[model samples]
Target: MARWSNWSGRQRSKPVAVQFVRSESDAAAIVRTANSAGRTVRVAGAGHSHSPLVVTDGVIIDTSGLAGVISTDAQQRRAWMWAGTRIHALGRALHDAGLGLVNQGDIDRQAIGGAIATGTHGTGASLRNLSAAVVGARIVLASGDVIECDRNRYPELLEVARLNLGSIGIVTRLQLELRDAYRLREQAWQAAFEDIAPQLESLARATRHFEFFWYPQTDMAHAKAIDETNAEPVYPLAAEGERCAYSYEVLPNDRPHLHTEMEYSVPAAHGLSCLDAIRTLIRRDFPDVRWPVEYRTLAADDVWLSTAYQRDTVTISVHQDIAEDETPYFRACEEIFLNYDGRPHWGKVNYLERETLAKIHPRWQDWWQARERIDPRGTFLNDYLRRIRPR
Candidate 1:
């Protein structure tokens, strides 16, 4: 047996075998062999997801070997990369080809496929989640068949594959709709919570990207904003301050694997009140806990299972240093989020079940139908994902 644990040292799994694949055919063969023996198969990327999405007792396929920029189309503003390519690597690779991602989250360690599966996003009023950026994918189905999907080819499948949560298939290559190469100027500032809370929406609207970090014991927060610029790059990028560099270089922060996180997206209108409620809960009960809360925004997207599906949203994340118990704090925060109609991030620490999950996503059944079309035999499903469906 092979042992695997996620980035946070949580969500461990002991699979019967672990195989690394360098090509689409290899992944398909592994899935086919496992299915023949009635064993479920799960693909593991950088293993950065905090959820148990990758936990399985069956065979584990490591896709890191199938990584790199494959091609670029400057005129169409699109690019294709192997599924296992890391976001940071893609950022640099894409920039060299006169293209860049529409947006990127602060952390860049996740595999492109994993990040898309989890509906990850950067902070911006106009930007949508990474799932929304996906224009096409080459997937290996449970039956050992390959499928290519895009807006014109199997368009309905493309919509489901956008945010399939790894239930659809093993994505070998991803086609991203991008932009002509660009640079960004990143600036950091501090502000009191009250002042910043009320202005989050306005700030998000005013900037290309905006987000903040708030600690439980403090009334103030560390805030940041990034916007495109034609100015010269800044040198000596400190731990924090200012920098002007390629969009990829400036967009991703150097995030150490310090804390495990819990994130949820609520309606944009409810962002401030939810923050206020969390602050009150933390102060009145968890005063000793000092991890920062992250606040960001996502434009509405149509990806069925996306946390921000069909509605503009505010994504708020709470974290605790990995050394401590994050349950009580995370669970309490979840309660408040649910009260405000928040949807949990698929890759983060969340206690949501199918009942609650189904209620929030209007296209719940449609997403399942898409999954059924891809893997009706449940060959790609792990016990964790099985819970995503109603009994």
Candidate 2:
């Protein structure tokens, strides 16, 4: 058996077989073969997701072989790329074509398909998650059928494919709506948590991108703000640390350290109170929790499975060092988030089951219906999907 593990080394699996596919046809063939053998099939991208979305005992389709830019339309500001293209590579490719992703998360190591599938996002009150920018995609179904979907084509299916949790089908290629290449100005500073907590709402409304990392054990918080600017790039002194660069270059940060993370989205109105409660709990009980808790805001989207579905959200992410036991901490935080009507990030760690998830997401059943239409046999369903999305 071939062993596989996630980026954070929290989830591991030993697949019966791992096949590296180079094209859509290759992926289709693998799916057909697996179906014929009565075995399940799952596709693995960069394996950045903390959840066991890709863990499988059957055949594993590795998509890295089907990578790179396929086509670009300058007039329409759209680009087509293979699903396996990494976010960083996509950024550079689009930049060369005078285009850029509308928004991106801090970590750029995830494959484009995986990122969109999991509803990955960045910090921006006005900007939507990466899934919203997906205008079209080519998905290979369980029976080896290739379906092309977009707004003009299978509009309904396009919605399902946008934020698919690998339960619908394997996305072979994607066509994304891009923005004209732009520059951004970023400023970062450290401040006390109490001082910034009260002003977070106004700051989020005013800035294009505003997020912060608050240390649970201390009163310190690292705040960052970014905004689109027409000014030329500048190099500032150490004291006046401001960076001006291309949108992609300035958005992603280098994360050399690894940790297990759990993130949930709450109603924008109750976000601050939730954060305050979490801070109080951590300080009073889990004194050993030292990792910073990240906070960011996101605009709502129509994607069915999106955490910010149909409502603006404030996302809170709690992390623990790789060496620490995250069970107690994550469970406690989950309880707090659930009190505020939180929706967990699909790709991150969480203990929510189907019954609970259905209660929180208004379109949960709708998403499952779409999943059944494309993958009736559940060929794409792995153990993780089966546990959370039972038949």
Candidate 3:
């Protein structure tokens, strides 16, 4: 049997066939043929998502073949590319065209399609996730029909498609709103947990981009803040110096290690309180766990399924080495996430259920109706989607 696994190796699949698709017609054909043969279909991106969204025993379509920049609207500051384009590749291409993505998460190895589908983001109180840059998309539906949607045409579809969790349909290409390329300067520092924890909100609000990783073993927080700059580019190898470079260069961290992670977004107003609770929980029981707890922020967005939907958000991420049993550590933090009205990142580890999801998202039913209309029989639905997706 042909097998597939994610970046962290936490989820795996033994698909009957792993098909690499190049064109929209080919993608549509595969979906049609799979449904006719009664085999569920799921498309594979960079295979970085931690969730079991793509695990299936049927056919898995690889989007790597369908990768490249299609065109750019330099005048409108917009660009669209085959959804399979990797974030790092896209950044280089856009930078060549004098454009850059507005924000990015720590890892840049993910395909742009997967990044947008999962609401990937970076740290900034005013910056929205990569999904928010989506101005439109070309989707190949479960029925083998292709359609386009944006602010002008099929506006409702754009709303749900912004962060569809790969359940709506196969997005062949995405149109993104770009910004004139910009540079950023970074300053790294370390301090005791007491020093940063109390001033977390002020620090986040003051910096253009800010985040900290609290190392549980030493009770020290390694903090980094980056701000827009016109200064000469300076690249440093040490933690105490200042580094200045393009936004893409300074924003993402290449986390090369294999690890299982869980992240949740809570209300911005309650960020410190939530962090305090998590800090207490870690110190009280799981102090021996050697990984750090991550803290970041995201501005509000209108995407119906977005964690920051209708409110500013503070995202907290916890990680464990791949070899460790993450169950006990993750479950305990999950209780705190749930208590603070936290919404889990779709691409990460989460235990959210249907009833809980509906209660949290005001437009939950609307998103489901839109998805069902696009793929009524769930030809694209997986076990994970079925569990959390509203009926």
* Range of the 10 consecutive residues with the lowest summed lDDT in candidate 2: 233-242
Residue pairs in steric clash, candidate 1?
Answer: none
Score each candidate by Cα lDDT: 0.89, 0.89, 0.88
lDDT tens digits, residues 147-215, model 1?
999999999889988887788788999999999989888889998887787777778899999989987
Which candidate tops lDDT? 2
Task: List where candidate 1 sits over 4 angstroms from the true fold.
Answer: 236-238
Superposition-based RMSD of candidate 2 using all C-alpha atoms, in angstroms: 1.8
Q: For model 3, how does the per-residue alpha-carbon lDDT over 1-391 read when each residue is reduced to its tens digit?
A: 9999999888999998999989999999998999899888888899999889899888888998888888987779999899988888887788888998888988789999988988989989999998888999999888889999999999988988899888777899999999989998888899998988888888899998899998988989999899999987675532322667887788777688899899999999988788889889999989888999999999999888888999999999999999998888899999999999999888899777899889878788999998888888988888888787775
Ranking by lDDT: 2, 1, 3
TM-score of candidate 1 on Cα atoms, chains taken together: 0.97
- TM-score, one value per model: 0.97, 0.97, 0.97
The Cα error of candidate 1 at residue 322, in Å, is: 2.4
Better of 1 and 3 by lDDT: 1
TM-score of 2: 0.97
Candidate 3, position 126, lDDT: 94
